[model samples]
Target: MGKRSRWLLWMVVAVGVVGVVATGSNGGAGEGEGKGKVLEPVVTRIAFGSCANQSAPQPIWNAIIDFDPQVFIWLGDNVYGDTKRPFKLFGKERTFGPWKNAPRFIPSSPKELESRYLKAKSNPGYSRLRDTTQRSRWLLWMVVAVGVVGVVATGSNGGAGEGEGKGKVLEPVVTRIAFGSCANQSAPQPIWNAIIDFDPQVFIWLGDNVYGDTKRPFKLFGKERTFGPWKNAPRFIPSSPKELESRYLKAKSNPGYSRLRHTTQVIGTWDDHDYGLNDAGKEFGGKITNQKLLLDFLDEPQDSPRRKQEGVYTSYMFGPVGRQIKVILLDTRYHRDPLRSDGSVLGSSQWTWLEKELNGPKSAITIIGSSVQVISNLSATTRPLFSLESWGRFPKERNRLFKLIADTKREGVFFISGDVHFGEISRYDCATGYPLYDVTASGLTQAVEKAVPHVFSLIVRFVAWLTPTTMRVISKNCRFRSCTYGQPNFGAIEIDWSTAPVTLKLEVKDIVGYPVTGVKFSLVELQSRGSVPSVKAGEHRRHCSLEVNLRWMIKYRLAILFYCSVSALLLAMIGLAYAATLAFRLFLHKCKLD
Candidate 1:
């Protein structure tokens, strides 16, 4: 090839380097793989999102259905946010939004909520989930039989581990869980089946699986754990589990839940519902107590990560180089300082720990989980109540986070978040720093108007404009930036880590598997800077090819002036060819005639 041709070919190869190619290990753990530490390099793809009110994940559920993922992380707000109820343990019930004003004279405490649980557990959805699995049916039958055999064997206490606050640690093999918000169960049912059928290594609960939030204002520890997670059994109160949360989870773990029980290892952290505090953090005085209560609900063996950290923060490792994904769940609310320059997203201890983690990174990919939007430039302020409750709220901390990732040179970092009642995908350029991509999933359900923050829609629009482009406002969808915890939705993050230059995709869908307007972009692992670079994106409308432009000419009139010269050379060559042909023909004429 000519020198010029070689250089042009090289340019094409160089351009191809920036675009990411997705390939990776078949995330499926080998059949009959023991439920121990998977020593084999794990090629894992995870789906994460949060803030789903238990109504029906409308328009958004489709995303979860189509994106059949391996691990689904529930960001938080799992149930319609039932606080003050017993750590609710019914099957599952859903509330469709347009947010309803909570009822007055709410169940006083766990005892009261237990009664409610009895009523709610009768829900069709709840019943199906509870009685779906054979093992679950057997357990239910056993619970009944054991109750009948009580006193003779073990006195009033009934059967073994009955109502005993001490939870049994069932080290999981593979668990299958259906992901859908509230009444929207069928929406992502296929995804759930895939999880079960495929039987991955783990499953996650992102949060907002139910919506039993108390309408009346609840003081810290206002309500208590209510009723048994199952049916009419001993209504005993152990520590932990907020009133409604207990009932809600019990309902979720129903026979329907059994299908998922022994399938895969499950781990999760809550964003809102389980705690009943929307967008709440440590700053909200109620958080510490809520955190403790949540710890109680998750009370597993001491070795369980949930019990160990018990904070809203945690991490998990998956796979080798084809991809190595490390997921870091942040409390955004727990240890965060104010948005001041000295503010902090990570508390002192967590910060140090996070720094240490970031300090050591050569992994193919990393993901950060925050229930609320982190990269979205918009805030939820239709009014102050719906005002910004995203990472943008704490600019100082947000910037610092960027600096940390960039300085640490961590690559393949993405944030999977939810809570705005809507869903979106965004890539942020830190003015000129590392690249951070944040994907928000708000599928599952919607909010009733005038939820919390009482953000006025008009005010919210103004706030969107005023909101600095950098302050959590990543897109033009005004609703996306705000903190409206009213609407419900399911969220998910899909990662392809089987090949070099890992690929991560963020998608949100309504309960029925429909459209969720969003964007997707990727980069080679080695080429990606932890943060979005400040380089301005080329904004030209008129299309122009570099080669075409380069070949056009150098100095202004040179092309026009040299045009004749070029034409002359071409003509001269043609003339020479004609003359030579004529001369040859003259010689050939004789031979031709012959």
Candidate 2:
């Protein structure tokens, strides 16, 4: 072996290492398939976190990658750059330096915000970890004492199994999911690092992704406004869709959001703040324009009906039958009926579509995401109190939803909601079916100063009713399972398939990713209680027949009475007209036939 031979060996070793890092051993996307193939993971490990404050040091980034989530979810409040200010350079010297900073400094402006996103994209940590066509892969490892190792499965084109006992295709699994909401850009956001450590396969944005362009004060400005302003930053209220788009551009560029964008797949819907208003609904003027911008920001499919439709509600199914999971995102803002409207909360078309979905097919677990609380009411004291924005406001619709679940006996169905700046769990155990659980997590950055108090006084309740916008700032009293208020927190839902019946674990974690409170439910517990006792056919028929006979008799009497009265009136009127005509004819005969 000479010097040249030794040099050749060294070069070979260097190239091999580079290939491993660049292409990844888990299986690069479209290795053999060719260009532009849709890629996914065989097993999804979602890391969900929201309420991002761009200026804050996101220590959570360190923790996020430690957990090694396959996807990152932005559950609303991704940024807090709210302002009516334009992209103009007003106080550049004040915020930046003698050296100019273009985008990030003006956190709320649209045009200037582009630079912020560019800056975020340039982050070395995010660039290195971001998912790419070359590095797309899932490295499955059993959690060990010190680390995770031991390859389980690996392939390209969304985790195709490579020769498992003579080439068996492995189905994708949705194992871990995390979510949260309500972030402020100026606030301290170390919790993101903790979320990274938790390591999820996918993240779900529960809404309030940003506190953009809101009139509400950052802290308590007045008794009427509970939610604070966007980190008390300079206001940047977008008047047009283009300006709003600019705001979105700035939000996407936030380092935390930017890093997550590269690291994993993200999906989300909007709350009032993100939708360009506080507690907005169907009457929102710029809904269509704002919706278009939102879809573009979310990278929604060009062919999706959401483009043509009025709302943003959508559903997605993952995995095969036995292990399948369905995620349903309900658009609570767009096309929502007015608070006290006679129609419905979900509107007519959406209501019909929802019913079809619930009755159509069954998934191992179904998670319904609402931007506001669904099961819990604001009142926990004596008289029932209600939230103007929650499902409680529309009792008719809420009961209809409950009845639908009971009628269809839908199983493994639970709700996840955000907003209200807190986290809690509530349950509605139906007599005819299994317990329905609603787990709400909120505020990745902003938390309430105090929980909404349980109201017992009638005077207070009446005042609240007259001024619904000024409802007391009260957090739910933990009765069902657990509750956490007045803290920046996130939520997690984990599904385990290692047993006969699948189990789901719901958790609410603080900014540091510590589980403040949690609850677990098994498939058996979510299912209907052994087909509601069947009604006897004979007895049911007898009761139905008797009711029908009674109704028919009453209807028969009413019909006859109406007919007789109408007939007598008509006869009298006709006779009177005839007599008058005869008298007129005698009088007219003396006059003219004209």
Candidate 3:
């Protein structure tokens, strides 16, 4: 062949090699789809997050290590960078993954950033998390491995007067199992090394990675801006670039994170704060446009559930074990209706997709990472401060969803989330008699939102109390459990897919201490002891009496449509009220009202 021909051949080989590495060897999002014989009874442990502060001393890493989770998920509230570009990464129907085009991999220029991720990873306490075994060979392999992608670089060159020594993009995203440790050790670093050290396969970002002036008051460009004086005491504020960079760097620098870099995988979806406000969406000025950018930062796949569907709700599976872990990353703020019209948590398009995913014949273990509280109630406070920014407001939608889960007989439905500045687990019964348990984890760094004054927050507490009784109605064959948890803490779920009855364990670890450890609960026995079940939440909204009838109606087209319409209408009413209140308050509080 001529010299030109040889060059072309070489070029093609190089391109092919890059493509393979980029898609997989470099680490792909969907690794479970691998050709390897998927092990049976897939053992999986998922670490769920809700509210993580963009601050130092996020000790929950200790709890996560103690749990030895296989996967970690960010349910939302990752940080508080409200002003940062591409702010609305969470609370949307359609979501893309992280942005790859950003200058994340470049090392030389990002000296400060490199130091940040590297030093955070190198924390001596997390050494055990990185070096899981004592053997020299294991230690050698871990130490020698290089070129891990878990290290992310963010910030800008200070063109817009951000004028710190330098500015990074300040994103709350990671796409690997582990990356660095002590990448850049800073002064007075929270004795993170003094506590339990552990590493996670994937560090899933829950949300609020940046605050973005969420709790503070004021309006700029027709958008909510930071104005202090809390609606509730110690109200949540948006995250600044420094805070965002700090949180990401600290985690990235930790050696335990290297697993996310080389050995394990990472994946996540967001809730609010990652956007700009607590319950914001596309119509919030240019927020929708920012949503697209957020997706890029997240590295979400276009063909994935969130991309193909309406909301950020998606799924992922790892290992075989005849188990599939479906992660429905529910966006609470994006397309939701205001509180006046019954309010919606998810828009119509996304709702349809959600039903299908739930009913689809696919997996045994279904884990839904909800950004907001699904079962907890907030009525004691007058402002609805504890109100239904969650599922409680959209009763119709929740009912429809419950019906779907029950009708579909979807088993092991675990709802994990953050945002309440607290944590709790509540088991909700389904029409099919199976129970859905929701676990809330908030404030990996910051403190939980305190009890607001009045009946609104009180009402929420009351409703929460009734959950066990309410769930008991559906769980005649099975029983449900419930409880409240607080932070600085993190949550985890462990699954034993080996035997006839699968075992699951839930944990909440306190990260404020040196040798961190916290609460734990294990469901060792598969209470149902039956085959995998399926149910569509919409089918049973008609108040069907017989279980057989509920299943039978699922086939009929009209029933589902009616349920959808009803849910939409209910959601709209509540949303309208909530929006009206906020709008009216803007006028009333300003002394401009007639």
Model 3: weakest 10-residue lDDT segment is 175-184
lDDT of each: 0.46, 0.61, 0.47
Off by over 4 Å in 3: 1-126, 129-198, 214-264, 301-310, 380-388, 449-483, 512-594
How high is the lDDT of residue 132 in model 2? Answer: 29
Runs with alpha carbons beyond 4 Å of true place in candidate 2: 1-170, 185-188, 216-239, 379-388, 450-482, 530-594
Candidate 2, residue 104: the lDDT equals: 35
lDDT of 3: 0.47
- Candidate number with greatest lDDT: 2
Which candidate leads the pack in TM-score? 2
Q: Alpha-carbon error at 137 in model 3, in Å? A: 9.0
State how far residue 458 of model 1 sits from its true place (Å): 15
Error of 3 at 291 (Å): 1.7
State in Å the error of residue 282, model 3. Answer: 5.0
Q: lDDT, candidate 3, residue 271?
A: 59
| Residues 474-536, model 3: lDDT tens digits | 212111122443325555555555545656655444454321222222333213434334445
Which tens-of-lDDT digit does each residue in 60-148 have in candidate 1?
A: 43344334333456676443434433232232421223443333224346765565546544543333333333333343333333322
Q: Is candidate 2 or candidate 3 better by TM-score?
A: 2
| Candidate 1 worst ten-residue window by lDDT | 540-549
* TM-score for all models, in order of appearance: 0.47, 0.56, 0.49
